[model samples]
Structure formats: structure tokens, C-alpha cells
Target: MVGRGELTDAAWERIGPLLPGVDGRGRSWRDRRKAINGVSWGSRTGAPWRDLSERYGPWQTLCERFARREADRTWARLLEHVQVRDDFVGAGEWRVSVDSTINRAH
Candidate 1:
């Protein structure tokens, strides 16, 4: 039962191998797929981290992993891979929107 923004089995098969596992103490991270799904949920919804659903596991874990991966360029690498693959499979669509609704004229 994959949600609207979740990674499907085939998508996971492509992405799971590329995620980092070793934590600061070398403890292999658990439930990474679950955490990633939560991350996806956050991105899709633009919701506060504290408001994340429990089924995604702790919000702290998802936030920390997202920050760490972002700092380490893992996200960039993964995006490049996904973009290339999607282009190859003809699923690629590029669009841009500039939203000013959140801007405040102070």
C-alpha cells in the first residue's frame, strides 16, 4: 500500500542500494526505507517535522538522516541517478514554478 509520494518496490530496488547505512558509531541504520518514506512525505506536504506521522518512525531520525545525507552530497548523487534513469525510461518531465505566496514584504 504505497502512498501517493512513497517509493514503490521497483523504485526502492533502484534507490535502496544507494543509501548510506553506517551511523556515527558504525551502527547500521535501521528502517531506512521507512525513514525515507517519511522524508518523502515531508517534502511532498511541506509539513512541520514535528507533525510527521508516527508510521514514518521518529521525526528526529528522518530529519537527522536527511540533513546528514544532504551535507554529504548523497542526495545530489541520488537525484542525478534518478534523473538519468527517468530520462532513459521517458518518465522525465521538467517544469519550474516560482511561488511568492510565502514571501513577506517586510
Candidate 2:
């Protein structure tokens, strides 16, 4: 499920130790992870939150959670954590494979 969200195994492994347990509120991290996964899938698929599948719990819940997470910069922290752990790899390895073109009048 995490892979389907475009999370690499190495990145997941690096971030796993830093994640708050979903059970932090007695709901279980597994459940929260699924909820987060729903957000990822929903975003990737451009599906409405109300259309999220039951396997991820209520779509409303995931949507609310995603909003809270965004407000709190949870995703940014996770990326920063991963970046810190991977700092030894250097910037040359962090290349983005993308193509873009711009028109300019000379």
C-alpha cells in the first residue's frame, strides 16, 4: 500500500522510526497509516474524498486528517527527516527527472 503511494522502501524504512504511532490515540498506527494511504491514493487518483474506499475508513475522516496534517506540516517534517538521514548521499544523487519548456521573446 505504501509503495502504491510512490513511497520507496528505503524512504519508508528511514521514516518508519519517526512516525507517531496511530495508536497514539489508541486507534493503532496501522489504521492511521491506512487513512494516510487513502489520502495519497485519493490525491493521486483525483477522487473526491467522499469516494474513498471503506478499506481506508471513512473518507471524511481521512480528509479531515489530511487537512490537519497539512496544517501541521507533517509531510514536510517527514521529508526533512528523510533528508537528514540521507544527507551523506550528497545533492548530485537527488536529481529530479522532469522536462519543461518555456517560450521567451528575444
Instruction: For candidate 1, write residues 1-106 as lDDT tens digits.
Output: 9888889999999999998778575456677788889998998899999999999988987898789889999989999999999999999997889789978778
Q: Which pairs of residues collide in model 2?
A: 22-29, 23-28, 23-29
What lDDT is reached at residue 90 by model 1?
95
What's the true lDDT of residue 26 in model 2? 38
Candidate 2 global TM-score: 0.62
Score candidate 1 by TM-score against the native. 0.81
lDDT of 1 at 48: 91
RMSD of each: 3.0, 4.4
lDDT of each: 0.87, 0.69
Best by TM-score: 1
lDDT of 2 at 32: 50
Each candidate structure's count of clashing pairs? 0, 3
What are the models' TM-scores?
0.81, 0.62
